[model samples]
Target chain A: MIKPTLHSGEFTYPEGTYFQAGYLTQKNAGWRTARPVLDTNACVGCLQCYLHCPDGTILETDDKKVTFDLDFCKGCGICAKVCPKNAIAMTPERGLSQ
Target chain B: MNTRELSKNEYFFGHKACAGCGGSLAVRIALKVLGDRAVAVLPAGCMSAVGFNFPQLAFANNAIISTFAGTASMMTGILAGLNARGEKDFTVVSFAGDGGTADIGIQALSGAIDRNDDILYICYDNEAYMNTGIQKSSLTPYGARTTTTPPGTVSRGNEFRKKDMLEIVRAQGIPYAATASIGYLQDYMNKVEKASKIHGTKYIHVLAPCPTGWGYATDDTVDIAKAAVDCGVWPLREFENGVYSETPARGGDKAEYLRRQTRFSHLTDEEVGAITGGSL
Candidate 1:
């Protein structure tokens, strides 16, 4: 997980604002009530979900199957809804063991 | 640009936007088109509030928060300052919400356009002010219930029509202007790309839905956005070179579109007909 360096009282900070791109120090998986489960066999690499994802958690794998970075996936179910082949399902997060 | 051809890099991500935020999607996609060279200016709206958290900024590209009403003015300043430093191949863009665009920031927006500043100002219209607990703004459509515009025994929600922002900007003779919806991603992407290439001031009013504000299922954000366009509540059109062109609506059922959103659930059939100009 990418984390931000916290400045202590003893250390002097930089004069100017400086940070990395896409700077997220925490996981947002707690926000999900339902998690998207991908069915690799049924996937056709359409990438509609990837395009529509607000969180940018959907990832295209080397073999053309799509996976997700659940650490930041808020599980908005957009991937499931936009899936043309019904390969993605939004399973309730309560019962599932990650 | 199609889905496959879009930039693999995620410029806007890892923020605290809601599960299915249409505004975030608009920002993410627009930034994707604009790329790293784009210097984004967001006002005190959803995108800014959720994006620029103190230590964890969501935008990969250079971005900053402007005053609530100073979005366009800040963009003008950025353009001027960058030009002074001899900067090139960079787009100065602002992502402001409906309240910021139509209500508080209209004057500055008008001023920027009047001066014909080189910038792209995209207003992600989510109907109401969603960041401050769903208050009604000028862009809120008729018959939609908000915290400020509640429907009661005698009063219907948001009695006024949505402000025609596209026409308003076009009236100022902006070089390019268009209306886009997240449901139609390709069209919106094309509009963003086209606007980025234009020399003078360009404006794109995108109809972004808010699941929390609109009282709909979170997953239905894109679906509802598309339905608004198809039902004629939000028309997809473009204004360029003093001419107006609109994509014909698919003529989707307006009543069904309203029925899906709880904000409009209180409306009677007669009231729904009234909202749709008696076409229903």
Candidate 2:
């Protein structure tokens, strides 16, 4: 997560634009109508979902499995659609028990 | 390069782009291929609007927003400035939309290519001016409904055919030019990788579907893009060193591709036939 430094009126503004690498400080999980639920046992790690995700929210696990960074995922469900093994399902966001 | 060998580091992430935004996907994948040393120039389109939000810049690389008609001009300036400073191993690229490319920024793009500038210009053609609401761009296909070209009594969406951008750039005698779709990931990736290694001006026009503008379910973005290519509505081709070659279309059902989108829901059989050159 990126922490933005707020600019107050006291300090002089720098001439050059200086910023840390781009990152979102806010979570877009609210945009999801349905969230993807992964079936790890049925998964063959082809990384199709990882390659096709529009938001770059899917991450490859160390053990060759895949996981979602729900904090950044807008729940587009491209992962579920591209999954060859049908290892992913789009469950309604409201149905998920927190 | 294969998917397994692609860079693990994400250069573009955490933006306000809509869920299943195809333009974002194109930018993300291209940036991944270009790596961190890429200097991205964006015009006043969806990308700059979504990515450069004051204190919340979404690009992980060095990115700046240029004027709407100045993406290529700005890229040339950046390349010149970098060259003056003895900079090496940096790729200067631009991500412009359909409106920015075929209409507003064509002159700048032509000038850059005429000069044989070392830059890469990528037009993520979503087929319309989607950022300011769906308006008809020069690249918007015939019979596709947009805000400015709504279908009505005696008027059927945009009447003009899409401007052939690949051919236009090819006519300019560019060193490299290619048309790609997000559906074919490996092909698009290879084109981007190949474009980066070339020394002169490169233009890649990628068919990036807009789910919001096209009135399709968000999950169907890639499927719709693939269908366009499969049905021969969008052709995948490349122009290099004065030669042109195209991937053969799979000859899929054009009606299936059209009926899925609300924009073409009102297209008559005759109109569809006309758009497909009686191929149906």
**Candidate 1 Cα deviation (angstroms), residue B59:** 0.9
With candidate 1 superimposed using the best TM-score fit, by how many Å does residue A6's alpha carbon deviate from the native? Answer: 13
- For model 1 the local lDDT of residue B119 reads 97
Error of 1 at B166 (Å): 0.8
RMSD of each: 2.6, 2.8
Candidate 1: residue B271 lDDT (0-100): 88
Per-model TM-score, in order, reads 0.95, 0.95
Best by DockQ: 1
CA lDDT, every prediction? 0.89, 0.89
Could you give candidate 1's per-residue lDDT for residues B187-262 as a string of tens digits? 9999999999989999999988888998888889999999988988788999887878999998899888989999
| Model 2, runs deviating above 4 Å | A1-18, B278-280
DockQ of 2: 0.47
The pairs that clash in candidate 1 are: none
